[model samples]
Target: MALSVGDATLAALAGVAIRRKPARSGAVHRTGAPVLRDSVEAGTFEEAFFAVPAKGETDRLLHVARKTLDAARRLRRDARLGAKILTTSERVIARLTGSAVRVYEEILTLARLNRGRVFPSYDYLADATGLGRATIGRALAILEAIGFLVRQRRFNRVAGQGPGPRYEQTSNAYRPLLPERVLSYLPRWLRPAPLPEDEVQRYADREADTRYMLKSLSCRELAEATVSGSLGKILAKLGAAVDRREREAQIDPQPLTDSYNKAQTVLA
Candidate 1:
């Protein structure tokens, strides 16, 4: 499936631009650092510590998140707009220093390892990225501000007896997001291909029929009569086809070679 971007208001965009400044020198990269392992220690997170979404949904979101960051890296390489004023989304991309990227990459690695269930604590992130907790926090804030990800705060429920505190904070559940404004930075070939004219018209007709059905049919009638035979079969087949395509997309994802030229040639 193609990536979906979240809507951003103009005011929100302006706020993002005003709040952040680019990082100057990149942080030190630790060489030969010990590989981070999950532990039962205070800082290490357990599976119960998180409230993650379904794997398939998270996987799709993660793919978009990766592409968005890739676009940011590409922009930094091509433009080299150092110290110049930038738009909201551009600034968000520009501010991703080496340290921030490292932190993000480590998070991605962990997410992949856990099969898209990501809820790493600050301690884990810092240890993995070889940066301090403060640096990890800042990087996460920036990533959140850019609409590249979301953090859901989770809390531990109190044990059997009544205690002083009902719930205590645990590791935040992280999910990736894609903001609409940053879509321009994505490579042309990576963008979703437009539907052919016939397919577009078919969908338009289906939408019109749907609207008519909503207006004309009662809820029970619609559920029982309208949803039988050809219409139901078509809907079921459509859903199955989408699921199949998504599975196929997961296998291939992005081809290195640009197929846009070939597509244009065929069209011509």
Candidate 2:
């Protein structure tokens, strides 16, 4: 079976190769036409090397790869991809020194490229990134604690059969979180607005003033108050409407008002 150009592109974008299993590796996986030969003497079926993807599987893989690339590209072009978030995040991250930044950069790369799902072992990352495993651990810890990243430890329940104890350690997935809840983590300049130091006192004072005004003022006066609170705004609208009607009455007296007075006299 020939590999398509789209499949090749997906393989490159995924940073992983999809190749035909070696002739002697183990049991072969079968898709429609038995791409893999079931070996009688081999280990469990799961241990079989994944054979080259069938046409349908390859099509699906390519579709997913294209979609992921499109999503990543769209994210880059987002209108909110402004300097403010980057500036704020950098100011906060500047406190850290050393390999943490390198590890973080690598994690960010993986997360952005894979849509927040990175599944590379420590050794793979170390080799690909040229950073010590211990440094990676420290960086991940700091990022996770600071809410800049989320780490999920995955355990490889099934181990591949090898000469030694099947090394069953799975890589941790690192997801980089966007600049959410920036106020707590960023500096005052980066935040939209800082709460006043006497915020609680100010709230108390406002509450007291609101209660006193509500108790002392008539509905019309309350509505017409200078303060722009929700209650005052509503009342002001009602008062304005009533005042407009009264002024119109003073201009030329309502015919309905005179008619009602005449009716009352007839009733009496």
lDDT of 1 at 225: 46
Q: Quote the lDDT for 146 in model 1.
A: 73
Predictions in order: lDDT: 0.61, 0.52
| Residues 1-268 of candidate 1: C-alpha lDDT, one tens digit per residue | 3322432454365665322232222322122112122212223343444444455544544555567667667667656755354666676776655666566666666666676578889998988878999999998987777766666654554454443433334677775555566667666655556899999999999999988876775444444444444345566566566667877899887754558777778899
After superposition, which runs of candidate 2 have C-alpha atoms over 4 Å from their true positions? 1-95, 159-167, 179-268
Q: Which ranges in model 1 have alpha carbons more than 4 Å from their true place?
A: 1-85, 160-165, 194-268
Q: Report the poorest 10 consecutive residues by lDDT, candidate 2.
A: 32-41
Model 2 steric clash pairs: 28-36, 223-235, 223-236
lDDT of 1 at 148: 60
